[model samples]
Target: MTDIVVSTDWLADHLDEVRVVDVRDGWEFDGIGHIPGAVNVPFDTIRAAEHAVERGADPAEGMLPGVETWEEVLGGAGIEPDDTLVAYDDTHGVFAARFLVTALAYGHADVHLLNGDFSAWSRDHEVERGTPEVEPTEYVARESETSPFVDFETVEAALTADDVAVIDTREPDEWAAGHLPGAIQLDWRELVDDDSRGLKPDAELESILADHGVTPGARVLLYCNTARRISHTYVALRHLGYEDLMFYEGSLAEWEARGAPLESA
Candidate 1:
């Protein structure tokens, strides 16, 4: 399916055919560990600083690293270009979604976000964990120039516009710690079902938006700590037929770099 959410059973059945990624930050994965055969890529390092110049990232923001950069990483992890990618993280679906969106934008098809994320995966008692075996291969990531990245200029304009809604998809603690001014909080965890396993029920998602006063035609800007999890919210909103959604690609990292206004509430 174009909508990729795989069950634990499915993952187990096809473990070797899928390139599983534990996209959690260093601290999170360090303590709790990850799936067997899954490789670790701390979320922010998605853009290789040295290769950014050729990978479609803004030069001023630091370009995204080229295909060789991803090639080295994925190749080192024994990943094959033909294999499906399955990503997961502890931060609900935000990081996983962000990774999937960026991967798709970079032309990596056959990608899936593990349904219900790490929580659901951990619920099963027989699952195995291991330090992934590493091997080498010549890999390449095809780049796309039109991935709809939102920069500071766009964010500034949206902030002043009455028609736009800037969403902060961080956890409640992080949101309370601080956020961009005029942004609304919507923890990504709440957007998925705890039982059925993938995205939240459609009616429930619509009700959540209604509670937040987000309407169909609203121009929405979605962001999280690093723009990782925010992309999932972007996809979720789009699924609900929100027509004018954009992802703040660099997210709070870029906002803080630009000295944008922020507040704690």
Candidate 2:
């Protein structure tokens, strides 16, 4: 697996070589300065609104959009399937990781997340005030043959499967309120280093996961309130060389909305 995290210094050296994507809100991209030559692809644009309703889930739940939508949104942002993408956001890589995960799911092979937050970049490097010039491309996205995202049925089955480990990447309060039965709590924040605001060392991360019974050997299924928080943990696990990993896209929102049984702390 390719190294999914790139340092700001590495990004600075190769800014022109890669497609720099600022995954912040539109207002933030324009109002706050951004890395020069970077294109703004707001996090919300990549996620589907009212997607849960289609899955018999809450109407407010956000899920990954369809292939056509991804093709349009990414292509409009001047991103081709073969583009070397580096996505960053103010939220310590979570929003950026979400974009990377979505791109990977759509078979974009050379995607990466910028290590640390955008604030650190803006503070140290020169930034542009407005949108950069972009010429849109006709991008075609193909769904990956082996996708990391798993549906509700797969998650439901995993609950009873001894080999599968269902991990809840939510806060203590959220897990306390309710979570899927047999789901182990591993808050996504633990995967990130507080000082650097990037992922912890690989061994440390692996140790943390192992402590929670989330070993790489086991088939890991991760989820949060939505798919957002878990995206960070997903990237972290991938970075640590975990192969048999899956994400519950609908997550707790879908689980609860569908009247599935839940176990509270």
Candidate 3:
């Protein structure tokens, strides 16, 4: 399955075929208008926990809600099991990528992240401004227990094992301050270079990994400040045909709270 990026023009052309999911929080969309026909899927709704990750915490936290909750949410959106899901958010696609990853984990065949997120779309003037009013639909409860995620315990165990490669997908500064023990640093920006947002290209991500001795079939456990940005790397790795890849959904905050062994490089 391919994760395709649709331009504003492209989205305009195939509005019916594609489902544009606006992942902005309530305040953002309510204050500012959103793309016409885009359904609001508030970022807060997909919480890792009742409370979220704290700033500057370790990178191994987040949780997937029960399948019943997901089914209600997806079904309420009128999402057909087979429709193409396109998710976007204002930031560097952290929210969008997480949602896309979540949906794909739920067995939705066609889920994509809007490149550069809503900010890029707005910069291109590719977005339509409107207060979308979607009628609440009757959601049928469909139970399925297949949420793709990794908890702090699993990450802690992997850190002690030589077989699993623990990757820190946070920035260089974050990596230097503190990171899980035995984890290798590979910034998420290495995968998606967003210079406009103070992100410089580590143009040779795969090469850098190769230098770090990350092999083709290495079992990777990817984590970041939050699971959001790292999910993009998770998707990209899978896209690159890596078979044994997994993302730590809770990320750094949770890991630090549990007092897991960490190293400052």
Candidate 4:
């Protein structure tokens, strides 16, 4: 498919032809088995620099890093812009989607996500229990118009847009704590299959979005604590044919840090 998600059988056949990225931490990679010939690229490696700062994230989570940063990390990991990539994570697709979003923001258009995540893959196929040798490359990422990677200012400005739906993809508790005014709380986990973390049946998802006042054709906006969980929601919405999809890169982490007003239930 031209879109980002891929099936297990499809991935199995293309392991050699495409670059398979295991977007899990080193410990997880060593403990849980991974796909053969896959390279381990941790999620945090490509995260925006502000996440590293202990204080108010100077920027915010999910903010796309600079060209030099992507060049170094992705290049050092042997990820070339030309290589067709399928990224996956055992953590229910959070890290995988994040990496895909980052890669796309930096103009790598060939990246896709494993349909059901690595956990689903492990259940159905044999997985190698060790890391594979990575042949690093000098892959330079050119900037593309990152349409969906919105910033705090853009999100704040779009809050009142007649055609926009600002969705908070956090848990109910988090939503109850405090959320952006008028932001609908639709937990990202609700949109996926329980085990595989793949997008749920299209009809079911369409109904869910409709129930929340998010029309299928609306310009959709998503955000969460750090923008990680929201990526799952973004992928699900995209699969459901929501064309005008965007993510608040500097999500609630940046919003609350800025002393922005929140509506506590």
* Per-model lDDT: 0.69, 0.81, 0.66, 0.78
Task: Write one digit per residue (lDDT tens) for candidate 3, span 1-265.
Answer: 2534444556666767777888898667766766667887787676545444454323333544445666677776666676688887877766777887777556665777666666666665545555665665554433224334665667667777787887788877898988878778876666664743212233455676677667677898887765676776776566545667767756454566667667898
Query: Model 2, poorest ten-residue lDDT window?
Result: 53-62
Cα displacement (angstroms), candidate 2, residue 151, comes to 2.2
Q: Which of candidates 1 and 3 is the stronger one according to lDDT?
A: 1
Worst lDDT run of 10 residues, candidate 4, spans 52-61
Candidate order by decreasing lDDT: 2, 4, 1, 3
Clashing pairs in 2: none
What would you estimate as the lDDT of candidate 1?
A: 0.69
Query: lDDT per residue, candidate 2, 1-265, as tens digits?
Result: 1688888888999988899999899889988878888899998889876545456643222377767888988888988777899999988899999898888778887888888878868767888887777889999987586468777777788888889888888888888899889888888888888777788878898899889988777888887765678888888877777788877766555567778899998
Q: What lDDT score is found at residue 114 in candidate 4?
A: 83
Q: In model 1, which range of ten residues has the least summed lDDT? A: 58-67
Candidate achieving the largest TM-score = 2
List where candidate 4 sits over 4 angstroms from the true fold.
Answer: 49-65, 251-261
TM-scores for the candidates? 0.67, 0.88, 0.72, 0.87
Residue 95 lDDT, candidate 4, scale 0-100: 76
Where does model 3 exceed 4 Å of error?
4-13, 50-61, 123-126, 138-147, 151-163, 171-178, 195-217, 250-264
Q: Give the TM-score of candidate 2.
A: 0.88
